[model samples]
Target: MKKILNDPKRFVDEMLEGLYAAHPGMLGYTGGDLRCLVRADAPVQGKVALATGGGSGHLPVFLGYVGRGMLDGCAIGDVFQSPSADQMLAVTRQIHGGKGVLYIYGNYGGDIMNFDMATEMASMEDIEVRTVLVKDDVASAPAERAETRRGVAGMVFAFKTAGAKADQGGSLDEVEAVAQRTLANTRTMGVALGPCILPTVGKPGFTLGEDEMELGMGIHGEPGVRRGKLETADQIAEQILATITADMPLNSGDRVAVMVNGLGATPLEELYILYRRVHQLLADQGVSIHRPFIGEFATSMEMPGASITLFKLDDELIPLLDHPAHTPFFRV
Candidate 1:
């Protein structure tokens, strides 16, 4: 496998070190645990603290959103592995303003368990904790069971929405409420044309035929709902939009926030080609887009694919999404 690193065992550690080096003024760490990254100006005295985390390899995900108006702190784990509860606890302690802390993360089994353990640990120290699990990937479960679906790129909206509320000095409950609301209004579907090689694993865990694609695949190469021959960009876009709309069913007067996200290796030009179709599809349905985002908001190492996320907006959600944020990776 062709990878860039000194030691696979040190991949997570070294990556964090590099992140700090690249943005020293904007990023900092909880003293002993390098994995717990925080905004340089953390524990803002009066504002609610927001913390989110997950495995590494998805840059701008658990860590990339750390800054003034995004995550106050984040607990990072090894690639595709949940961060330890202790790591979560350390970040909690680092960013706990008297206003309390809220933990926002994707809805994965390991992430949920570890974050829960950290919440319990924080309660022992009298730190109030709240959580909002993002479960927006439509392909992971039936429409009747969205709560069971895995969170994907839709969380970019979650982080921005909830972080804006917190940055506005909203209480922990208020922040948590907005986080859940944002998640509830979001849906995501992805298609992967190739696979990614994990450094430690030394190879791709799953593979696709040269002329094949997997629809609704997870960021870590989790099985999607379908596997079939590669289709044209228009066909792929139609399949994704059909599946998402069948579940969510945007109406004629509905408004949405569209995100065309690259899984990792998908080029920006290709992403726009896909987004053009997404825009047209929504327009044809008479749905208005608020602000369309296009880029690699979330990734899976070097995997070649993309995911589309639509955030249904209401009168209340529009402002929260447009709130200004200053993060190392995300700015709004």
Candidate 2:
């Protein structure tokens, strides 16, 4: 119950206000709706606009990725809640370019339902909309049904690929193809050590013992496959990497982009500790690491955990990934 805030009901509003204040030149809201944050230079004419929406708490996510070379607009809901279809539709109409719009978001039930409705609403106005759901969490479901699996940190890769394609004047179909290809080639797995407290709930979303950790946990405190005593950083990394690599089956000569993301509260030092083992393990397997990103790319408030995402890269994908991208939270 220990949190610093003036009012729980206004948490999301206050946070958005602070965000716009800090980056006025880069971001702004549409029609004064806190749920809709668009780039300062959005609605690029005659180009395909990329829009994504999801719940709050997972910062640097649904909102932070909105800017040049990334998302043109984002619709944000409350913590762990999906945005209303109307809200998503509003952002869609405001940012739709003459070409069309592409919706890239994680694989979640609420998001799927609302985005689908929004697509239909946009169709009435002759604005074409497509979607690419990121389903990379190996822990969410069996390999046979990975498409139904929950999306996790691997979403960041999808955003980069789609955004790069859009930035290069690619058509909506081209952007959709690249996003799907990236999603198909990516795999991720995560472990949780502690839970995050929701601002409104005024308590931890879940609880764990001091010496216990949960394997295969989802970002929103979803149940993991196993719970047991905590292990060393190397051990944890091995477990997660094994699941991801097994699902994807990377060869010795393969190249990949490695992302070791902290859920929220995990420190950079700990993430680097895990990354050290991750790099060594991949090297031992003869897999080459091309570009590595290690930090809080996606998170669940202040949860204590990390996830590993591997995107097997080809020539086209590698270059698109290397393309310059500038956002409020990610610059490369």
Candidate 3:
């Protein structure tokens, strides 16, 4: 309930206002609506455009990646809510640089519905659109039903690979292919220690005991696979890595990219501690760490938790992951 703001209803508006104000010429909006955010230098003619949208509160997520080598546009909604189809369509139109547009987002019902509606609407305007839903949360569903799982921090990998492909002059189909490929090779497992309060609601969506944690919890406080007493950092990392490696077995000679992401309230030091374990564990398996991303890549509005994402990599994806990308919150 404790947050710094003037009006509860104006939270998103004011946040976007400040974002635009702080990053002028680097970011902007469409149709005079701040909800439909796009790169300032949008419609880079003939380049396939990448767009994503989801609720707010997860900053640098649906909004932060809109930049030089990432998403071209995004349709933002309220905290943990989906944006309207109209808003999505506005972003699609504004960033459709003549080649086509690709929509990459998590596998959530509201988002799927609205993005599909936007796709249909864009078709009437002759804008070709392709959709790729990120289904990387291994804990959400069994391997056989992974297609039904929710997307998590792993979607960031998809964003990077897909965006790099598009910026490199790949066609719509090519970019979408890279996105799907990246997501298919990614797996994520999260543990939550506390819940985040919504700005308007002014209360935590869920709660955890002072000495407990929930393993494999969703970013939105959805039920996790296990709940029990809190464990040490190394223990948490091992547990998460066990599940991830089981799902996507890492071979002795395989190379991989790892990300230890904070769920908002966790500090940078803690993230690095988690990453250290991840790196050591992977090394023990003879897997080389091609790259490591440790930070608050995605969040739940001050939620206390962290997620580990393992992205099985090959020669093709390494370059894409290493590609220079610049956004307000992320750079590589």
Candidate 4:
């Protein structure tokens, strides 16, 4: 790999050091372990705390969202690796306010195992803990088995919705409910043109042809549902929209929040081009978009591609989604 850095083994640590320095008082880590990061002003007494953990390389994801009106803490792992249960428990202990703590993260096997262990450990200490798993990648599983699908960019909506609820002083149950609701209404489809290189591996995790693309690829380089010659931006948007709508059919007067997310290396200009077509297609269906989030909300390490996420909104969710939020990597 031609990436810049010294000692691939220290990649995650060095990155955390820079992240802490950049954010300063806004973000801090538990104990001396940089993997267990939390808001600098954590344990907002009596407020429900939100925590999430997952493999690294997907920034603004499990870590970047920690701040006011978002996650209270995050257990960070190495690139494409799950954080240990001990790290997760450390974050839970550091962020648990008097009210309770809620664990919200993607539906990944490693994360599920580690987070579940942390939850049980916290429960023994008399700390109430709740969990909400995000599963919105429609291509990962059939509609009948959505719960088995993987989580992707749709996590942004879940974090925003649930974080707003917690910031509004909602109970733990209420916050978890809103997170579940947001994810239930969200669906994501991704197309990747290239793969990313892990620091330690020093090679691309997957390969794609010069004139090829994979539809519905996972962030960690998992095989997509289909691979074929590359298509136009409009065609890509249409295919993704068709798949999402088939899973969560939209009707006239339905409101939604659209996110055209860049994987890592895709430019904002290209994302907006895709968004332009998405807008037209949604308008054609009589669906009104309440908000259009266009940018790199989630990413793989230097992966060239994009994902589209559609969050079907309701009267209650619209306001929560619009609620003011401020974090290092996200704001509203």
* Candidate with the greatest lDDT versus the true structure: 4
- On the 0 to 100 scale, the lDDT of residue 66 in model 2 is 89
Compared with the true structure, all predictions reach lDDT values of 0.91, 0.90, 0.93, 0.94
TM-score of each: 0.98, 0.98, 0.99, 0.99
Q: Candidate 2 on 25-96: residue-level lDDT in tens?
A: 998878668788888877888778999999999988878888888789999999899999988998998888
Residue 251's C-alpha lDDT in candidate 4?
A: 99
Cα lDDT for residue 311, model 4? 98
User: Which candidate, 1 or 3, has the higher TM-score?
Assistant: 3
Comparing 1 and 2 by lDDT, which wins? 1
Task: Compute the lDDT of residue 81 as modeled in candidate 1.
Answer: 92
Per-residue lDDT of 107 in model 1: 88
Per-residue lDDT of model 1, residues 191-294, tens digit only: 99999988899988888999999999999999999999999888888999999888888999999999999999999999999999999999999999999999
The reply for model 2, stretches above 4 Å from the true place, is: none
| Cα distance off (Å), candidate 4, residue 213 | 0.2
Question: For residues 1-332, what per-residue lDDT tens digits would candidate 3 score against the true structure?
Answer: 68889898999999999999999989999899999999999888989999999999998787999998899999999989999999999999999999999999999999999999999999999999999998899899998998899988999999999999999999888898999889889999999999999989998888899999999999899899999999999999999999998898899999999999999989999999998899889899899999899888989889999999999999899999999999998899
Better of 1 and 4 by TM-score: 4
